[model samples]
Target: QGLRRAAKVQAGQKVLVIGAGGGVGTFAVQLAKAFGADVTGVCSTKKTDLVRSIGADDVIDYTREDFADRPRRYDLILDIAGGRSLSHLRRALDPRGTLVIVGSERGGRWAQGVDRALRAAMLSPFVSQKLRMLVSTENEEDLQLLGKLIEGGKITPVVDRTFSLSEVPEAIEYLRGGHACGKVVITE
Candidate 1:
């Protein structure tokens, strides 16, 4: 929804998905490609291969390279669970591009990433680049679209691991350790 509705992804446009190996990032990468955009993914070194295998045209290892330092700029950028400063992200975004922040787990408990989103909203009117925050509201309409996309083989969810119902604590720990390459599931 963020890509299609918010960023208004169009064919052949360069789209970058930060944190491309995570749960939401993996799907964002696939969905952007399915929408006919050229997708670039940013991830840690350990997840580079997974990102590429999922159809990213380019994968940047954030450990070794800063995407903002590159000469190329993206028409749309989805910052998923990333903590990069707004200025840093803008350097890699086209002047007229759209930047969408999705579910960042940064900041303290009180503000809890809302600070960045609020700042973005405040700064948007003055900037040429559109800086927006995506707060996903689940609805059947979008779910149907996702179902069709999945049925058509345009997108595939990557499940990194699954834990039984009794192993919830272990599952949570695994996710907190930041070792998951994709979605971690707790099965009943």
Candidate 2:
């Protein structure tokens, strides 16, 4: 609901996907492409080509410079890492742009994303631009839709590494290291 409402994406708007090489980010880039938007994916140097191969029109290497420093504005900014502050994010947004704060987990042993989402909700009421916390739910229809998109070649999932189900603890540790370029799935 948040994505559909905030994005209201027309056929030709520009979307900036921060952390576009991660799990949700990979999908965000592809879906934005399928939605007919010109997608710019921001990631580290190593993931630049991966971002483009997944369907982003452009890829920004975040390790080299600050994306928020650029004068170029975006109609929609989907911030997944939550590394950038709200003020910094607003600077890159168009006047009435939508900001979707997706999973901001920094892989802390204790969770960090929930705090950011709470703050965004409190600050949103006074803001002119749409500031939203994306609380996603497991829905059969949405899953089906995603599957269809995958089958249609409009979207693809990037799994960086897979760990055996018995090694779930090790998988969590690896994710906490934050070096994985994509998702670390536990396979049965």
Which candidate achieves the best lDDT against the true structure?
Answer: 1
Can you write out model 2's per-residue Cα lDDT over 99-144, one digit (the tens) per residue? 8888755543445556666676788889887778787778788788
Deviation from native of the Cα of residue 49 in model 2, angstroms: 1.3
lDDT of each: 0.91, 0.81
List the pairs of residues colliding in candidate 2. none
Score residue 71 of candidate 2 by CA lDDT.
Answer: 81
By summed lDDT, the worst window of 10 consecutive residues in model 1 runs over 104-113
What TM-score would you give candidate 2 relative to the actual structure? 0.89
TM-score of each: 0.96, 0.89
Cα RMSD to the true fold for all candidates: 1.3, 2.6
